[model samples]
Target: MDRIRDLASKKAAVIFTKSSCCMCYSIKQLFYELGASPAVHELDKEARGREMELALRGLGCSPTVPAVFIGGVYVGSATDIISLHVDGSLKQMLINAKAIWF
Candidate 1:
Protein backbone atom coordinates (compact mmCIF):
# COMPACT_ATOMS: atom_id res chain seq x y z
CA MET A 1 0.00 0.00 0.00
CA ASP A 2 2.80 2.38 0.90
CA ARG A 3 4.59 1.52 -2.32
CA ILE A 4 1.42 2.11 -4.35
CA ARG A 5 0.85 5.48 -2.72
CA ASP A 6 4.49 6.42 -3.25
CA LEU A 7 4.38 5.59 -6.96
CA ALA A 8 0.99 7.25 -7.45
CA SER A 9 2.28 10.47 -5.97
CA LYS A 10 5.42 10.67 -8.11
CA LYS A 11 3.76 12.58 -10.92
CA ALA A 12 0.91 15.01 -11.50
CA ALA A 13 -0.96 12.24 -13.29
CA VAL A 14 -0.35 8.51 -12.89
CA ILE A 15 -1.93 5.37 -14.31
CA PHE A 16 -1.57 1.93 -12.79
CA THR A 17 -1.93 -0.51 -15.65
CA LYS A 18 -1.33 -3.99 -16.95
CA SER A 19 0.71 -4.35 -20.13
CA SER A 20 -1.82 -6.31 -22.17
CA CYS A 21 -5.10 -4.76 -21.08
CA CYS A 22 -6.80 -3.08 -24.03
CA MET A 23 -8.70 -0.69 -21.79
CA CYS A 24 -5.42 0.35 -20.24
CA TYR A 25 -4.07 1.11 -23.68
CA SER A 26 -7.14 3.16 -24.52
CA ILE A 27 -6.95 5.09 -21.29
CA LYS A 28 -3.30 5.87 -21.92
CA GLN A 29 -4.10 7.01 -25.42
CA LEU A 30 -6.85 9.23 -24.08
CA PHE A 31 -4.40 10.96 -21.77
CA TYR A 32 -2.01 11.45 -24.66
CA GLU A 33 -4.77 12.88 -26.83
CA LEU A 34 -5.58 15.30 -24.05
CA GLY A 35 -1.89 16.31 -23.96
CA ALA A 36 -1.27 15.09 -20.43
CA SER A 37 2.00 13.25 -19.96
CA PRO A 38 0.86 10.88 -17.26
CA ALA A 39 3.23 8.51 -15.50
CA VAL A 40 2.37 4.92 -16.29
CA HIS A 41 3.12 2.02 -13.99
CA GLU A 42 2.68 -1.32 -15.72
CA LEU A 43 1.81 -3.66 -12.88
CA ASP A 44 2.49 -6.82 -14.88
CA LYS A 45 6.10 -5.80 -15.40
CA GLU A 46 6.83 -4.82 -11.84
CA ALA A 47 8.35 -7.08 -9.22
CA ARG A 48 5.63 -6.51 -6.63
CA GLY A 49 2.83 -6.19 -9.12
CA ARG A 50 0.36 -8.62 -7.57
CA GLU A 51 0.79 -6.96 -4.20
CA MET A 52 0.22 -3.60 -5.71
CA GLU A 53 -2.87 -4.82 -7.51
CA LEU A 54 -4.28 -6.00 -4.22
CA ALA A 55 -3.51 -2.65 -2.71
CA LEU A 56 -5.29 -0.92 -5.55
CA ARG A 57 -8.36 -3.08 -4.89
CA GLY A 58 -8.23 -1.99 -1.29
CA LEU A 59 -8.29 1.56 -2.58
CA GLY A 60 -11.57 0.87 -4.47
CA CYS A 61 -10.36 -0.03 -7.97
CA SER A 62 -12.71 -2.81 -9.04
CA PRO A 63 -11.08 -3.93 -12.30
CA THR A 64 -7.68 -3.31 -10.73
CA VAL A 65 -5.71 -2.22 -13.77
CA PRO A 66 -6.01 1.20 -15.34
CA ALA A 67 -6.43 2.81 -11.97
CA VAL A 68 -5.80 6.51 -12.31
CA PHE A 69 -4.44 9.14 -9.98
CA ILE A 70 -4.27 12.86 -10.62
CA GLY A 71 -2.69 15.33 -8.27
CA GLY A 72 -1.82 12.30 -6.17
CA VAL A 73 -5.48 11.40 -5.83
CA TYR A 74 -7.14 8.19 -6.91
CA VAL A 75 -9.56 9.02 -9.71
CA GLY A 76 -10.93 5.57 -10.64
CA SER A 77 -10.83 2.86 -13.30
CA ALA A 78 -11.44 3.13 -17.07
CA THR A 79 -15.22 3.53 -16.92
CA ASP A 80 -15.00 6.32 -14.41
CA ILE A 81 -12.36 8.06 -16.46
CA ILE A 82 -14.42 7.74 -19.62
CA SER A 83 -17.43 9.18 -17.83
CA LEU A 84 -15.33 12.09 -16.65
CA HIS A 85 -14.12 12.63 -20.19
CA VAL A 86 -17.63 12.59 -21.66
CA ASP A 87 -18.68 15.16 -19.10
CA GLY A 88 -15.62 17.31 -19.92
CA SER A 89 -14.40 17.13 -16.35
CA LEU A 90 -11.35 15.00 -16.99
CA LYS A 91 -9.53 17.67 -18.95
CA GLN A 92 -10.29 20.23 -16.32
CA MET A 93 -9.00 17.86 -13.67
CA LEU A 94 -5.81 17.39 -15.63
CA ILE A 95 -5.32 21.11 -15.93
CA ASN A 96 -6.03 21.63 -12.24
CA ALA A 97 -3.52 18.93 -11.39
CA LYS A 98 -0.91 20.58 -13.60
CA ALA A 99 -0.81 17.48 -15.76
CA ILE A 100 -1.70 19.74 -18.68
CA TRP A 101 -1.76 23.43 -19.35
CA PHE A 102 -4.65 25.30 -21.00
Candidate 2:
Protein backbone atom coordinates (compact mmCIF):
# COMPACT_ATOMS: atom_id res chain seq x y z
CA MET A 1 0.00 0.00 0.00
CA ASP A 2 2.31 2.72 1.21
CA ARG A 3 5.17 1.13 -0.60
CA ILE A 4 3.27 0.96 -3.83
CA ARG A 5 2.10 4.56 -3.45
CA ASP A 6 5.65 5.66 -2.70
CA LEU A 7 6.94 3.90 -5.78
CA ALA A 8 4.23 5.55 -7.88
CA SER A 9 5.16 8.93 -6.45
CA LYS A 10 8.85 8.84 -7.18
CA LYS A 11 10.25 11.58 -9.39
CA ALA A 12 11.89 9.03 -11.64
CA ALA A 13 9.92 7.18 -14.28
CA VAL A 14 8.42 3.72 -13.80
CA ILE A 15 8.40 0.93 -16.38
CA PHE A 16 6.33 -2.16 -15.65
CA THR A 17 7.60 -5.05 -17.69
CA LYS A 18 7.90 -8.80 -17.82
CA SER A 19 10.97 -10.97 -18.36
CA SER A 20 12.19 -11.62 -21.93
CA CYS A 21 10.23 -8.64 -23.17
CA CYS A 22 12.16 -7.03 -25.99
CA MET A 23 10.43 -3.69 -25.67
CA CYS A 24 11.24 -3.67 -21.99
CA TYR A 25 14.88 -4.25 -22.79
CA SER A 26 14.86 -1.44 -25.34
CA ILE A 27 13.23 1.00 -22.97
CA LYS A 28 15.64 0.09 -20.20
CA GLN A 29 18.55 0.66 -22.54
CA LEU A 30 17.25 4.03 -23.64
CA PHE A 31 16.58 5.24 -20.10
CA TYR A 32 19.93 3.99 -18.93
CA GLU A 33 21.61 5.88 -21.76
CA LEU A 34 19.79 8.96 -20.55
CA GLY A 35 21.19 8.41 -17.01
CA ALA A 36 17.88 7.71 -15.37
CA SER A 37 17.31 4.74 -13.11
CA PRO A 38 13.68 4.16 -13.76
CA ALA A 39 11.91 1.90 -11.28
CA VAL A 40 11.07 -1.42 -12.91
CA HIS A 41 8.15 -3.55 -11.80
CA GLU A 42 8.11 -7.04 -13.25
CA LEU A 43 4.45 -7.69 -13.85
CA ASP A 44 4.89 -11.38 -14.46
CA LYS A 45 5.99 -11.95 -10.89
CA GLU A 46 4.50 -9.05 -9.02
CA ALA A 47 1.90 -9.83 -6.39
CA ARG A 48 -0.69 -7.46 -7.85
CA GLY A 49 0.32 -8.02 -11.46
CA ARG A 50 -3.19 -8.66 -12.64
CA GLU A 51 -4.47 -5.51 -10.97
CA MET A 52 -1.81 -3.51 -12.72
CA GLU A 53 -2.78 -5.11 -16.00
CA LEU A 54 -6.38 -4.14 -15.50
CA ALA A 55 -5.36 -0.62 -14.61
CA LEU A 56 -3.34 -0.27 -17.81
CA ARG A 57 -6.17 -1.65 -19.85
CA GLY A 58 -8.56 0.81 -18.24
CA LEU A 59 -6.23 3.59 -19.26
CA GLY A 60 -6.58 2.55 -22.91
CA CYS A 61 -3.27 0.81 -23.19
CA SER A 62 -2.65 -2.84 -24.02
CA PRO A 63 -2.19 -5.17 -21.07
CA THR A 64 1.16 -6.25 -22.34
CA VAL A 65 4.82 -5.97 -21.52
CA PRO A 66 6.58 -2.63 -21.02
CA ALA A 67 3.81 -0.48 -19.73
CA VAL A 68 5.40 2.84 -18.85
CA PHE A 69 4.42 5.55 -16.44
CA ILE A 70 6.06 8.90 -15.94
CA GLY A 71 5.14 11.10 -12.99
CA GLY A 72 2.13 8.97 -12.29
CA VAL A 73 0.82 9.37 -15.83
CA TYR A 74 0.44 6.42 -18.14
CA VAL A 75 2.65 6.81 -21.23
CA GLY A 76 1.47 3.76 -23.13
CA SER A 77 3.60 1.14 -24.94
CA ALA A 78 7.06 0.83 -26.47
CA THR A 79 6.04 2.47 -29.75
CA ASP A 80 4.75 5.46 -27.83
CA ILE A 81 7.98 5.66 -25.84
CA ILE A 82 10.19 5.46 -28.94
CA SER A 83 8.00 7.99 -30.65
CA LEU A 84 8.51 10.34 -27.72
CA HIS A 85 12.23 9.90 -27.95
CA VAL A 86 12.35 10.31 -31.72
CA ASP A 87 10.23 13.44 -31.51
CA GLY A 88 12.56 14.86 -28.81
CA SER A 89 9.94 14.91 -26.09
CA LEU A 90 11.47 12.29 -23.81
CA LYS A 91 13.89 14.61 -22.06
CA GLN A 92 11.22 17.18 -21.48
CA MET A 93 9.05 14.44 -20.13
CA LEU A 94 11.76 13.38 -17.71
CA ILE A 95 12.27 16.94 -16.58
CA ASN A 96 8.57 17.38 -16.06
CA ALA A 97 8.32 14.08 -14.28
CA LYS A 98 11.11 14.98 -11.93
CA ALA A 99 10.01 18.57 -11.55
CA ILE A 100 13.57 19.58 -12.21
CA TRP A 101 15.33 21.09 -15.22
CA PHE A 102 18.73 22.53 -15.97
Candidate 3:
Protein backbone atom coordinates (compact mmCIF):
# COMPACT_ATOMS: atom_id res chain seq x y z
CA MET A 1 0.00 0.00 0.00
CA ASP A 2 2.76 2.39 0.93
CA ARG A 3 4.67 1.54 -2.25
CA ILE A 4 1.65 2.11 -4.48
CA ARG A 5 0.95 5.42 -2.74
CA ASP A 6 4.58 6.37 -3.11
CA LEU A 7 4.60 5.58 -6.81
CA ALA A 8 1.34 7.44 -7.37
CA SER A 9 2.86 10.59 -5.90
CA LYS A 10 6.07 10.12 -7.89
CA LYS A 11 4.45 11.90 -10.80
CA ALA A 12 1.94 14.68 -11.21
CA ALA A 13 -0.27 12.16 -13.01
CA VAL A 14 -0.15 8.39 -12.85
CA ILE A 15 -1.97 5.49 -14.47
CA PHE A 16 -1.94 1.91 -13.27
CA THR A 17 -2.59 -0.08 -16.44
CA LYS A 18 -2.33 -3.41 -18.16
CA SER A 19 -0.58 -3.81 -21.48
CA SER A 20 -3.23 -5.90 -23.22
CA CYS A 21 -6.38 -4.22 -21.91
CA CYS A 22 -8.28 -2.11 -24.42
CA MET A 23 -9.48 0.25 -21.72
CA CYS A 24 -5.94 0.84 -20.59
CA TYR A 25 -4.92 1.40 -24.21
CA SER A 26 -7.66 3.94 -24.61
CA ILE A 27 -6.56 5.84 -21.52
CA LYS A 28 -2.99 5.97 -22.75
CA GLN A 29 -4.13 7.11 -26.17
CA LEU A 30 -6.26 9.82 -24.65
CA PHE A 31 -3.33 11.18 -22.67
CA TYR A 32 -1.14 11.01 -25.77
CA GLU A 33 -3.69 12.96 -27.78
CA LEU A 34 -3.70 15.53 -25.02
CA GLY A 35 0.11 15.78 -25.23
CA ALA A 36 0.48 14.53 -21.66
CA SER A 37 2.52 11.58 -20.50
CA PRO A 38 1.33 9.91 -17.30
CA ALA A 39 3.54 7.64 -15.29
CA VAL A 40 2.05 4.27 -16.29
CA HIS A 41 2.40 1.11 -14.25
CA GLU A 42 1.59 -2.03 -16.20
CA LEU A 43 0.33 -4.51 -13.62
CA ASP A 44 0.06 -7.60 -15.80
CA LYS A 45 3.72 -7.41 -16.59
CA GLU A 46 4.88 -6.89 -13.06
CA ALA A 47 5.77 -9.53 -10.48
CA ARG A 48 3.75 -7.81 -7.78
CA GLY A 49 0.73 -7.18 -9.97
CA ARG A 50 -1.78 -9.11 -7.87
CA GLU A 51 -0.61 -7.57 -4.65
CA MET A 52 -0.80 -4.08 -6.05
CA GLU A 53 -4.22 -4.71 -7.54
CA LEU A 54 -5.51 -5.86 -4.15
CA ALA A 55 -4.02 -2.82 -2.53
CA LEU A 56 -5.62 -0.53 -5.07
CA ARG A 57 -8.96 -2.24 -4.59
CA GLY A 58 -8.79 -1.64 -0.87
CA LEU A 59 -7.96 1.98 -1.58
CA GLY A 60 -11.33 2.43 -3.38
CA CYS A 61 -10.42 1.77 -6.99
CA SER A 62 -11.85 -1.66 -7.59
CA PRO A 63 -11.06 -3.40 -10.84
CA THR A 64 -7.89 -1.44 -10.40
CA VAL A 65 -6.26 -1.93 -13.74
CA PRO A 66 -6.06 1.36 -15.57
CA ALA A 67 -6.71 3.22 -12.32
CA VAL A 68 -5.77 6.89 -12.38
CA PHE A 69 -4.23 9.32 -9.93
CA ILE A 70 -3.69 13.04 -10.25
CA GLY A 71 -1.66 15.04 -7.76
CA GLY A 72 -1.73 12.05 -5.40
CA VAL A 73 -5.50 11.81 -5.61
CA TYR A 74 -7.42 8.81 -6.92
CA VAL A 75 -9.48 9.86 -9.95
CA GLY A 76 -11.34 6.68 -10.87
CA SER A 77 -11.18 4.77 -14.15
CA ALA A 78 -11.57 5.30 -17.92
CA THR A 79 -15.36 5.67 -17.63
CA ASP A 80 -14.85 8.53 -15.23
CA ILE A 81 -12.45 10.14 -17.64
CA ILE A 82 -14.96 9.80 -20.47
CA SER A 83 -17.53 11.52 -18.31
CA LEU A 84 -15.09 14.30 -17.55
CA HIS A 85 -14.32 14.63 -21.25
CA VAL A 86 -18.00 14.86 -22.12
CA ASP A 87 -18.24 17.73 -19.67
CA GLY A 88 -15.12 19.40 -21.12
CA SER A 89 -13.39 19.17 -17.75
CA LEU A 90 -10.78 16.51 -18.39
CA LYS A 91 -8.36 18.94 -19.99
CA GLN A 92 -8.69 21.35 -17.11
CA MET A 93 -8.12 18.53 -14.65
CA LEU A 94 -4.95 17.57 -16.42
CA ILE A 95 -3.85 21.15 -16.49
CA ASN A 96 -4.61 21.52 -12.80
CA ALA A 97 -2.56 18.44 -12.07
CA LYS A 98 0.31 19.88 -14.10
CA ALA A 99 0.14 16.93 -16.43
CA ILE A 100 -0.07 19.20 -19.46
CA TRP A 101 1.18 22.69 -20.14
CA PHE A 102 -1.89 23.91 -21.98
Candidate 4:
Protein backbone atom coordinates (compact mmCIF):
# COMPACT_ATOMS: atom_id res chain seq x y z
CA MET A 1 0.00 0.00 0.00
CA ASP A 2 2.73 2.41 1.02
CA ARG A 3 4.77 1.32 -1.95
CA ILE A 4 1.90 2.00 -4.32
CA ARG A 5 1.39 5.43 -2.83
CA ASP A 6 5.05 6.21 -3.08
CA LEU A 7 5.09 5.28 -6.75
CA ALA A 8 2.03 7.36 -7.49
CA SER A 9 3.50 10.33 -5.67
CA LYS A 10 6.83 10.00 -7.35
CA LYS A 11 5.80 9.25 -10.90
CA ALA A 12 2.26 10.53 -11.15
CA ALA A 13 -0.20 8.19 -12.88
CA VAL A 14 0.92 6.68 -16.16
CA ILE A 15 -1.74 6.45 -18.85
CA PHE A 16 -0.65 4.39 -21.81
CA THR A 17 -2.37 5.74 -24.88
CA LYS A 18 -2.36 6.34 -28.60
CA SER A 19 -3.07 9.61 -30.33
CA SER A 20 -5.93 8.28 -32.41
CA CYS A 21 -7.64 6.54 -29.53
CA CYS A 22 -10.90 8.08 -28.35
CA MET A 23 -10.83 6.06 -25.16
CA CYS A 24 -7.45 7.57 -24.39
CA TYR A 25 -8.91 11.03 -24.65
CA SER A 26 -11.78 10.11 -22.39
CA ILE A 27 -9.49 8.64 -19.81
CA LYS A 28 -7.31 11.74 -19.83
CA GLN A 29 -10.31 14.00 -19.45
CA LEU A 30 -11.67 11.86 -16.64
CA PHE A 31 -8.41 11.93 -14.76
CA TYR A 32 -8.18 15.68 -15.18
CA GLU A 33 -11.66 16.04 -13.78
CA LEU A 34 -10.57 13.86 -10.90
CA GLY A 35 -7.74 16.35 -10.23
CA ALA A 36 -5.05 14.00 -11.32
CA SER A 37 -2.43 15.12 -13.78
CA PRO A 38 -1.69 11.78 -15.28
CA ALA A 39 1.40 11.30 -17.42
CA VAL A 40 0.58 9.88 -20.81
CA HIS A 41 2.81 7.54 -22.74
CA GLU A 42 1.87 7.25 -26.37
CA LEU A 43 2.34 3.66 -27.36
CA ASP A 44 2.46 4.31 -31.07
CA LYS A 45 5.21 6.90 -31.07
CA GLU A 46 8.29 5.20 -29.85
CA ALA A 47 10.12 1.91 -29.64
CA ARG A 48 9.81 1.99 -25.90
CA GLY A 49 6.11 2.42 -26.30
CA ARG A 50 5.99 -0.76 -28.34
CA GLU A 51 7.93 -2.51 -25.64
CA MET A 52 5.46 -1.26 -23.10
CA GLU A 53 2.56 -2.55 -25.14
CA LEU A 54 4.14 -5.97 -25.34
CA ALA A 55 4.82 -5.92 -21.64
CA LEU A 56 1.21 -5.03 -20.92
CA ARG A 57 0.09 -7.92 -23.11
CA GLY A 58 2.39 -10.19 -21.17
CA LEU A 59 0.73 -8.95 -18.00
CA GLY A 60 -2.69 -10.10 -19.23
CA CYS A 61 -4.06 -6.69 -20.12
CA SER A 62 -5.79 -6.17 -23.44
CA PRO A 63 -3.42 -4.71 -26.02
CA THR A 64 -5.53 -1.68 -26.55
CA VAL A 65 -5.67 2.02 -25.89
CA PRO A 66 -5.90 3.67 -22.49
CA ALA A 67 -4.05 1.23 -20.36
CA VAL A 68 -3.81 3.20 -17.14
CA PHE A 69 -1.38 2.66 -14.34
CA ILE A 70 -1.85 4.13 -10.93
CA GLY A 71 1.34 3.77 -9.01
CA GLY A 72 2.45 0.56 -10.63
CA VAL A 73 -0.94 -1.09 -10.81
CA TYR A 74 -2.69 -1.75 -14.10
CA VAL A 75 -6.06 0.02 -14.06
CA GLY A 76 -7.40 -1.16 -17.42
CA SER A 77 -9.08 0.87 -20.20
CA ALA A 78 -11.05 4.13 -20.44
CA THR A 79 -14.39 2.49 -19.83
CA ASP A 80 -12.97 0.78 -16.78
CA ILE A 81 -11.71 4.11 -15.52
CA ILE A 82 -15.10 5.72 -16.04
CA SER A 83 -16.80 2.87 -14.23
CA LEU A 84 -14.45 3.33 -11.31
CA HIS A 85 -15.34 7.02 -11.19
CA VAL A 86 -19.05 6.29 -11.44
CA ASP A 87 -18.77 3.80 -8.64
CA GLY A 88 -16.69 6.27 -6.61
CA SER A 89 -13.85 3.83 -6.52
CA LEU A 90 -11.42 5.79 -8.66
CA LYS A 91 -10.24 7.96 -5.80
CA GLN A 92 -9.78 4.98 -3.57
CA MET A 93 -7.83 3.24 -6.27
CA LEU A 94 -5.65 6.28 -6.67
CA ILE A 95 -5.09 6.39 -2.93
CA ASN A 96 -4.20 2.71 -2.99
CA ALA A 97 -1.85 3.55 -5.83
CA LYS A 98 -0.55 6.46 -3.77
CA ALA A 99 -1.91 9.12 -6.14
CA ILE A 100 -4.07 11.03 -3.73
CA TRP A 101 -3.89 14.29 -1.84
CA PHE A 102 -2.56 13.59 1.59
- What residue pairs clash in candidate 3, if any at all? none
Candidate closest to the true structure, highest lDDT: 1
lDDT, residue 33, candidate 3: 90
Cα-based lDDT at residue 98, candidate 1 = 94
Model 1, TM vs. native: 0.98
The residue pairs found clashing in candidate 2 are none
For model 3, what is the error of residue 41's alpha carbon versus the real structure, in angstroms, after optimal superposition? 0.3
lDDT (10s digit) by residue, model 2, range 4-96:
445656756888788778888999889888777788888778898777766656667774668777887778789999999999898789887
Cα shift from native, residue 5, model 3 (Å): 0.7
Give the Å shift of residue 40 in candidate 1: 0.4
TM-score of each: 0.98, 0.81, 0.95, 0.78
Error of 3 at 24 (Å): 0.5
In model 3, what lDDT does residue 27 have?
Answer: 88
Candidate 3, poorest ten consecutive residues by summed lDDT: 62-71
lDDT of each: 0.96, 0.77, 0.89, 0.73
Q: Choose the strongest candidate by TM-score.
A: 1
lDDT score of residue 21 within candidate 1: 99
lDDT of 1 at 29: 99
